[model samples]
Target: MNPTHHRRRQLRSVGTITAGAALAAVLAACGSTAGATAQNAGAGTSSGSSAAAGQPVSGGTLTLALDGDPTCIDPAQTSLTNTLSLGAQFTDTLVDQDFETGEIVPALAEKWEISDDATEFTFHLRDGVTFSDGTPLDAAAVKANFDGIIDLGAASFLGSSYLADYVGTDVVDDSTAKVTFKTPNVPFLQAAATATLGILSPATNKLTADERCQGELVGSGPFVLSKYDLTSQVVLTRRAGYAWPSAAAEHQGEAYVETVVLPIVKETGVRAGGLQSAEFDGIFQPAVQDQDALEQAGFTLTSRANPGNVQSLFANTFRPLVAEEAVRQAFQKAIDRDEFNATLFNARYAVPSSVLSPTTPGYTDLSADLVYDPEGAKALLDGAGWTVGADGIREKDGTKLVLKLLSSEATKSAAELTQNQLKEVGIGVEIEIPESSQSFKVRSAGDWDYTFSGLTRADPDTLRRDFWSGGQPNSAAHLTESPLDDKILAQKAEVDTEKRWAIVAEIQKEIITQGYDIPYGSQLQIYATRDGVQGLRLDASSRLRLYDTWVQASS
Candidate 1:
């Protein structure tokens, strides 16, 4: 059951690039907030062969349409996928994950080792690397970056969650640093491969967290944040002497594109139209309904399954109507996940059978309890002393079964569909589509009865981050002092992968049985590009890797 034990069998040979040779040359390069959110679906390869295919052509600007403006460009501060996508363009992590095999590979740190107890992580930094501001990226810089995240406290929601159980970091030398944890942190190694834990320049780290969010942060990546217009766009220019690229990067030199312009296109229709008309070279979160038209127009659609938590309608148990276990269970049973996926995602996305997506390591099938049973839901509501009123909404003790549902604009359609589905079972839901950052604020404040969201991480430990009472963004059903918390903590500290998997399975069962979360399906991280664009890749975590992407001239 130890997922890593089966990693050898799961190791897939991808493209013509061997990881060992890539790392030896890396002597090398470097390296979401969506609950494993929606991405376009296609085979995991670059799109179209043209004059610019096969080799990277080092010029031309790549304009991408983003579904929303980034909440913040600071990697240590925001967890939203839009912001994470922007972060990837200008920040570098200590490690990287192979897009195909999900293997951990070298990036900023040439190599790393973990202690037997799993409490100590020692990283050997690559020499001669420097941040955009001409600052050396040494071990102290890495420590400063982590220390900055620790200093942000609750402000660094996603970043702080990744560094849980931290004792402190020790800079052994210019090229060496040792990170110590009070408890075994089996997820830290993979967390280091994420953008949230990416290293920043010490000069930028010296700024207050608020200052960094205002665009003061710097990194040793392939691009520099040349312009940031909060309401309009973000502009990045390729770094001149950038050489260190992640082992998973398509090339080991400067980025092929001279610049990347990420324009905020909040509406899916606008994004799809822009890509089809060539007003934008690429777009994120294209509408599923637009896939066929885009293909007919000679555009290529691509997506990869996000490898983490499944998309679910999270009920806020702290709310009065949802406070009853029976009510929550009724809500779970009322959801028709099959119909939801079919209508919103077509067949490209997988309907989740458990809280975790199939792509996640140690995932287990837990679909029996997830079947759609409208009658069973009604019975549960009736048993809880709820009766349907003449108006169709259920009533219990003078309280109507009406709840406010919050979601981002990206998920509004699905939220509306859910509203209709829940109505069929005598529950009334009012949907609210807020801006992405505002939506997170409302969910974190526990101000809404339910919210639709998901987080994407290759590690199963994401469960701890999402469900632990002490977790960052701690938005899990307000269940404190439950045995579930104990199991979650145990899994986090369990170094043996197999035992950890068992503990996670138990935790998933507990959540499902207790009706803590109502999972619907996994999200396919999709993107659309004009034909002849090459080297676009979605990493294992579903964020874009565009460092080596190139635009071929139209024939």
Candidate 2:
């Protein structure tokens, strides 16, 4: 037999192991964020055709349409939804996290152990796993990737955020590696299950960050990147002789689809039209207005509420106009989240009750605090010495109370709606729509008074990642000082479930009561798939996982 055939035979013979009893109990108790489910027209219905019977017959191409180009295909370098979805197909993480149960099961690593204080994690590599590039997946390879991620520094936003305290990974042996952190990282195990911590081939360590972003990376995933064109499409071909699969994944061995094609379709209408014409098998983020029509036209709509941060407008506290607590309070009170949702989203979305999404763990309902009170807002503005001028805009100290709101195409519509809502209370909101690539740069520079975005993660540690002022140079809130910082930090170290959650609660209350995060609604990832597109589902973090996804044969 050829070497490839022999390797495949050996890999197929490899057995899997269950996670440690201690770690499994902790993870299971924590539970996952909301499970991602595929429902036709938001009703519980499978996307696959009824006529297509028998087994999952594969060997077809699955073409998915994306809203924008994933400028970087490197998993560690970006947490953007598009890039993450793409990375999930071509990369594998150390462990697999259950979407419904939050159990930390084996993936590339067959088993793992956690230290008593939760500061250290030891992962045992599975036997007979090799990267598509022919590199051995071992303990040394794990160390190299961790070191490389730390070296990427701020460039790996999500990765850097996950690995906050850098100690290093120790190669105990060829298959055993121990990861250590300076501070207790209770979230590290769950973080390991995220694509940001997905393992890459050690050979990729030789490439610069830029080269890696340009798709110069290799993984032991079921699929390998065959073509990556930033302007057009990304093509993933099923890796031959692949055997190891995540324990959380529904199936074992190779992916059913021979090839997966992701084409950038900037216009939602264009994507919808393509799906209708059978030009695309599935499309990401189909507009709310188009959801019903697509479902009526025989397409299935799969949606999962993105956990962690809600779609919120964060106050850049450094901005002059928003520096005063009164102004910030007025801004929060003026927002009619109900109206915003009814008007813009056809009331399909759940209005935000707190800084964290309702789907997130430890989410506290602060709807009473988030009540829409325009008169109260006017009172706050008036008391702050901001008088409504003849132009119907608030003015104080020879300056119009106009706040610059930074937004992107994704949130531009919502921002515009906010502008009108704020206008009612005599507060002028100047929406500054920036290029997608420039959005982060502008926010990081503190050039806007308010900005809109959301972070999706299963854990509440996402709050610290986005809101904690220290170490987070790109903190949207621009919080120089706050008690919330302490609460955020405390939650990370508290391993006791009740204690950690209590801290998380205080953090959410602090974020909203102090006017740091003005939430609008839950962030939901909705995709439309034509019939016969089976097994498409979102992972715990609301990212697309195409491993078990298959395209049914046409009758």
Candidate 3:
């Protein structure tokens, strides 16, 4: 959201559509049956919780703690984990996909249709929807938001990759909006579900992108931002006349509680203590240690496997030692994924066997392709002719097999595990610890040889820019340029569903086989919540659909 936040500067819409009625066919084949039973399925949340077992409770403020601060309320231009805080108070996307099922349900626009050729999308806005500011939410307001993002050139990531050729949008009437692309973009439908594309009120659109940072934010949701002290806390009160666009939520009318406060408590220990002391009704406790205490106290713990977000070590291909295919293969085989998953995760995680996690559509079981084989690893390096020297360190033609690894100081555990894993393969890893901001600058400059990194993207296009090649998305050490990749990327926007997938699989194979995207480990967007909350859907994209949530007040 900052003017200087230019990581993937020249990127496109970064959408991954795979259209052509393929999704329709897939849904039809899967049938209309609900996969999980509601009685047992993980559904319920603090956001949509009712006051009683059946009745909607009219007023109460919900306070929460976070490990970090939200730098921007603009979803289109941020990547921090804290966007979940902003998401509740603001959103009006044409469609918000159920993060888990990838359902193209209503959000701001009640319904929509894609052109036969797939290049044009027409949205039918709901009749009575209004922004939190009380102004009518119309097509014109939606058009203004898109234009603002482009003219400002402020969305460094979205503009550069996914929306590179974002042409323009038009408002046909107060109820109709049309977004036309230069080509048939596969990711547009799905990207519309992301926070990056969340609709802004006409009021917010009037403020310059930079000027928006000076004060509180507004959104067309069940909650309203009542107070804000940028670096301290955000207080939101329920919109009394709220009318939801879809039946996805249980409480479709006015919210159950009166208010909710998102507090800026940044320490894990302190937040855990607050939850322990009942200083808060519920808190987001991510660590395993907090889970036990919460459960022991009769709190309900909700868990689900998250899709599209990955955590891994990306090698910088610029250094001569890491440039070879054999070295990358060796690095892959040397680490015991089970050891790390067991020791570090308490068996709560899976070793990432492929780039596409299990939650992603068309995800295949690729454990064989990711088997741990030390002897095979040594053979690959030997075949590449990197002889084992007397020091047990690898060397080829006087160049040492070495790299400088960098990551945020906050996630030191995963970063350190990567260090030990690479060392097992006879590679030398140098660690660099920088504060979150400076570390970001260091990675964007492509200055490191390898770093522990991950992305929380819902579609395959996210994988394309991250590892397919060139510029900012390629955090694979030093070799960041990709002309052939650029060639393949151009057609992705227009290709049909099946063909696009074939292309995506090709890109994944290319990155792995060519040693660009070093396959690391698979992970889910995990969370820890206390009991008393009920009926929240943890969507596949790892967001909590809080509309249906209800709670049992202390009797």
Candidate 4:
């Protein structure tokens, strides 16, 4: 038999081991097991027949449309949603999450064990794995990846946040590696399943962070980066001799599609039209208005609620006018979250009840303070010594009650609607939509009163990455040292399942009570695919996992 056939035969005999049974059981006590079922229920509408029931076939090119150019190809440096969407195709994490049950499963690492204190984790690497560059994937490579991310510092916002408590890693043997943390990092295991912590080859790790961001990284995933044009497109070719795959994966060998192409198409109309005309196999972030038409045309629309902080208008308390707690509370009570979901998202998105979404692991309902009451909002402003002028804008001490709201082109419509809503409550909002890169600069400089954004992750510790002032400074509300920060620290330090959740609940309540994160609604990462495509799935972080995706032979 040929070498490829022999490898397949060997893989068939090696059974897959799925981990995190205890973790899944513990989470079930906190929330429903079918967390993603509600979001995926409308996947292929009743009017259209399911296209996922065909036999898998190989040897076809899958053309996917991206909303914008990926910010970076390096997993550690990628911070944008579009970048994560593409990075998932070429990077393999130590672990993977079960889409249906949210359980951690084996991926690059065959299995792992967490210390009783939850401060240390040891992983057993899979044998015979090799990077696209033909470099061996071993314990040393994993250590280099983690160490490299920590060394990148602020340049790698996501990576730095993920490894904030990381102390060091020790290679126990050729296949065994132990990772140590300063504090009890209960979320580190789940984080290991994310692309932010994906391992790169030793050669790739040796390059400077800037060089890796320019697409010089190598990974051991099913696809290899064949061509990367930062401004235009990215092409990936299937990797041969890849027998190992995650336990959640449908098949264990090479990907069904030989080549995958991701082209940056910023316009929603163009992407939707291309998918409709069969010019593209799939499209990311399909317009809400186009969902009905796309489904009616027999395309499948799949979505999952991102599992971290909801999309919110974060009030920078450090700003002058917003420094007043009353004004910040008024901003939270003034806008109608239900209206925003209805008008902008067509109610397809989930209305968030807390700083964390329902799909998040430690989510708790704190919606009592999030209700919309324009009169209450006005009363709060009035009590704060702000008087409405002839122009309908409130003023106090000769300063106009105007706040600048920063956003990107994608969120311009929602920002405009928010402007009109706040205007009714005697607050003036100036909407500024800047270029993507410049938007980051504006946020980092703290030049805006409010910013629209969200962070995606499967663990509740994502709060630390966003809210911890000592970490990513400008990502979240930019609130330095507060009672909520203390609670977040407490939650991160505790490892007991129930006790940790109690602390997490209190943290969410404190965030809502303080009005730092004024959540609008939960955001769903939506993708639309033409009929006859099968096996496409969304991982826990709501990124597309196309390893098992196949194009069914045309009938």
Candidate 5:
């Protein structure tokens, strides 16, 4: 338990960028303390790729494998990592935050200004940028995208949450657009850098949100979506005459990889095998046990910790088993986080200290509150009048202490482990792993006592989206109106970094202390690439940036 583990780690590398002095003041006031400038230094590239240190060579397809299929490919709607990663290839954001310095830099928008109150953001667009559909990227397009997200409502997922206090976006002129919020939103600039906020062609406004999920949307990115099939794969062909790239990109005219193919390989072992056999150029989320073998065979494993919600099991308060406050607190104490990580994952994963992952800004160290305490758990259950029955299961008022746990294939391992641990304290956990497409339907129906899930974002406001009562895409814990809701709302409007972070810290404390959510381990995005892959780097939000990624041809 080193004290340094609880402190924020410094960014490993540095690069210089020059913006206006006024922008510097905005970074100091709104970005610096809020972790808007914070860049992930935890990205590690293991030895073995043949072109790992070589100069880029263009014109080859990078056939990457994704562990899960994205339900939606629409930038405005998806919140899943795999979906956003795919979208990033075919979509571009308004601005780009530097991966090293976290400075706001030009992308589709050449320059921008933040009002003193942090409510209005004005952007000046670059000339001659057009979507693959021949639609010009202009202020009107930006307004259309924003207005569309607002119209989609919760279906827009992260986009709607990011634009929570949306007032409106004013089309100042052909090139300039001013986006104003009802309250001060310090996180909006960095939010703009995310793929979820990636701009789209105004023609997409005609499509319903579900139709957009079918992957017919056009974007002005380095690649174009040629095909999307749920059962097979999603293909992106290189966009010719493409000149726009994020300021953080290494080098770009068009993506060096000529055509990018993402095959939906749902099994982790199959993905690893595909990479090992050279059937795939890269694979996402190789199993922890397969890491050593993959690296030994000359494949490079790149990893970056996700910065929003940790891999957590959120209690459904509406469920009878977890409805009791004492029972919820007992469930937290009964599980051993260290054992869970050590058994299921390896050193690559971290034990989460708070509801928010350590890589997130405004993360508070709540390891003290999260320590393993089986004896304390037993006592709490006893005091709550639940007696251990002859079958070694807790019982009270003729009801067995069995709780239902909902999980997907990706989260099933952790859910199964949680079930085993809670059994030690006379609690019965019924595991229910549903199909990926059925996950949302099952969760929305409230058929389970606890659901295992996580989210990846660069800001602390992610907590608001997860725990706040009225948060977007629906709250994970299904929390109702409470003091926690007030704090979550307050932090969003408080533009002052220190004060806002203090409020975020309080929100974490309240979530942990009240037993609303139990974080088991931090979520890290890992990819295994074949020997010839080069220049692949992760963006600020841990999504793979493939603009500079190129694969060398075999000699």
Candidate 6:
């Protein structure tokens, strides 16, 4: 199945906001990246509230802290959702995006076009441009970077899945190139704008994959890689002669600031404490506690409903209890989403109903109105032949209602919340299972009942990979793949825009109607910044772009 076949497998897209809206506005602030914004769970953030949040200021440094040290800084090799996104803040894509509208405008490749059937795309590479290393960014350079990524195969899911086919790119001229897919691949441009496809210089490709472990990290963006030590941190400096930037960017030459530092901090308390103590200038992250504090601290809270992040409870269909359609429905019914939204997350999150959020391109409110109906849940379980046992748990065919609720160190707290709530429905939930990597193996191996997991991407096609039949665990992975899901995905890819929504709506209905996994909500996005940071914007893709920032009293 192609990546676009069942687009909603990834994060859902929410509604759109016009330009000049809070998030789309790139205003200057006193502190620049030094300012801090509050965070809340499931509730993502983009600073708003303060009118000056839209003001502009330049000249200073921005200190950032990431969740962890990256597995690899070679954007093509790794796929830590946030790692590549952070790279976007420092690297340039073939095209740029408007966050408020998600429109693909232009970036490195000045302009592009598509064939009549929409199967081919030709990009006119910009001239007078080169990587930080001074190597020209010609059409040949673009082909080498992408072709090399595709060669990595499974190592680059972003390239493989996002690019659709292993098709080659043709260099029409020094400043122009055309790419041909096996079939209609309109979203290629959108994917091209992703960091995974950031055009690297010839020097980048020359370095051994391991040697290039964040090596030199030169790009045509406003920031140049100064230092990248996996165990330490990734440091960057402003490009001295930089000029090209997003049209919305202000003071567009070399950035006003001199440096950008991204440290590694994983603990929630540490992240929050570090932000509050002024130990860091800015962060691209979300947390339940920080957002609550920000609200009370009078910090700006700018958020728009988008299917940005995902927190999923994967129901192991191979397990008898979990395989029962009614039992899966029971889990959803027992979940107090509002309580989770208001209490567990400090009212910073929203419970998402559809597999693909309403914000997704083909989104619909098909299941948005679904309610927590315990009575209905119980009725379905009764019909499934599950009866209450002596220990207050249900049993059928000598199997108890017990199911392993797998979680990692990161999600332990969320698991505890799940355990507390699920007991009310007479379901036995247990934690202390394997970690994420292991859980992926176990679930794909069909060794467990369910695994708590999630995925986030900028496009609707992400849904197809996660839920569609072909996206099932690989054969060697020994996981679930459904023919029904496969059929649904096929229908979506060929359906026209107007009619595609109808198909997507049905798919959402089916996902909810079957209740394979209980989607808590698309987790919120948040960041903390000093009051002085400016020229910060987050597009629908959740990319971090700060090339236009300036500090008030920058050194």
* lDDT for each residue of candidate 1 in 1-555, tens digit (9 for 90 to 100): 654323322222211124323222221221101111223332233322121346677899889988887767787788777688678878898989876666789998899999988899999999889999998999899899898889988888777888987888899999998999998888898899988988888898889877888888688988998888887898999999999998988678899889898888776655655554456888887666655455545566667777677888776666788778888898888999999888777777778788887767667788898999999999999998999999999997798999888877667777888899999999998888777557556667777777777788878887787777665346555454567788888887777889988998898887776677788767777777876677777777778777878887654
What are the models' TM-scores?
A: 0.85, 0.88, 0.84, 0.88, 0.86, 0.83
lDDT for model 1, on a 0 to 1 scale?
A: 0.77
In model 4, the runs with Cα more than 4 Å from the true position are 1-38, 41-51
Better of 4 and 5 by TM-score: 4
Alpha carbon lDDT at 263, candidate 3:
74
The total number of steric clashes, by the backbone 3 Å criterion, in model 4 comes to: 0
Better model by lDDT: candidate 1 vs candidate 5: 5
RMSD of each: 11.8, 11.7, 11.4, 11.3, 12.2, 9.8
- In angstroms, give how far residue 370 of model 6 lies from its true place: 3.7
TM-score, structure 3 vs. true: 0.84
Worst 10 residues of 1 by lDDT: 27-36
Residues 321-432 of candidate 6 have per-residue lDDT tens digits of 7777778888877776666666556544556656655444555553443576667667777788878888878788998888787678767767887887776666788775
lDDT agreement with native, every candidate: 0.77, 0.79, 0.60, 0.78, 0.79, 0.62
In the range 1-555, model 4's lDDT, one tens digit per residue, is 565344334333433221122222322443421211114422112111123565778878888888888767787887777777667777788998876556789988998999888789999999998898888889999999899988888878887777767899999997888999987877888888888888788898889977888898789988988888987888989988777788978787988889989988776666655664466788888777666556555567777778888888887777888788888889888989888888877656877788887777778887787899999999999999999999999999999999999888878877998899999999999998888768777788887888888888878887887777665454677776777778888787787878988999888887777777889867788787866677777777777888888886433
Worst 10 residues of 6 by lDDT: 14-23
Which stretches of model 6 miss by more than 4 angstroms? 1-57, 116-118, 247-251, 298-309, 366-369, 435-440, 474-488, 491-496
How many Å off is the CA of 262 in candidate 1? Answer: 2.4
Candidate 1 runs further than 4 Å off:
1-52, 319-323, 382-404, 407-412, 430-448
Local distance difference test, candidate 6: 0.62
Over 1-555, each residue of candidate 2 has an lDDT whose tens digit, in order, gives 565344334323432121122222322443423322353221122221212225776688999989888888898888788888788888888997675555677898898998878889999999998999998999999999889999998899788888888699999999999999999898998889888888888889879999999998898888999999987999999999889988877788889899999888766556655665567888988767666566555567677677788888887777788779999888889999998888777544677788887666677878899999999999998999999999999898899999899888768778989999999999988889878777777778888888887888878998887788884456656776677788888898888888898999888887887788899877777887766777776777777888777887543
Question: What residue runs in model 2 are displaced by over 4 Å at the alpha carbon?
Answer: 1-54, 397-399, 435-437
Best of the two (1, 6) by TM-score = 1
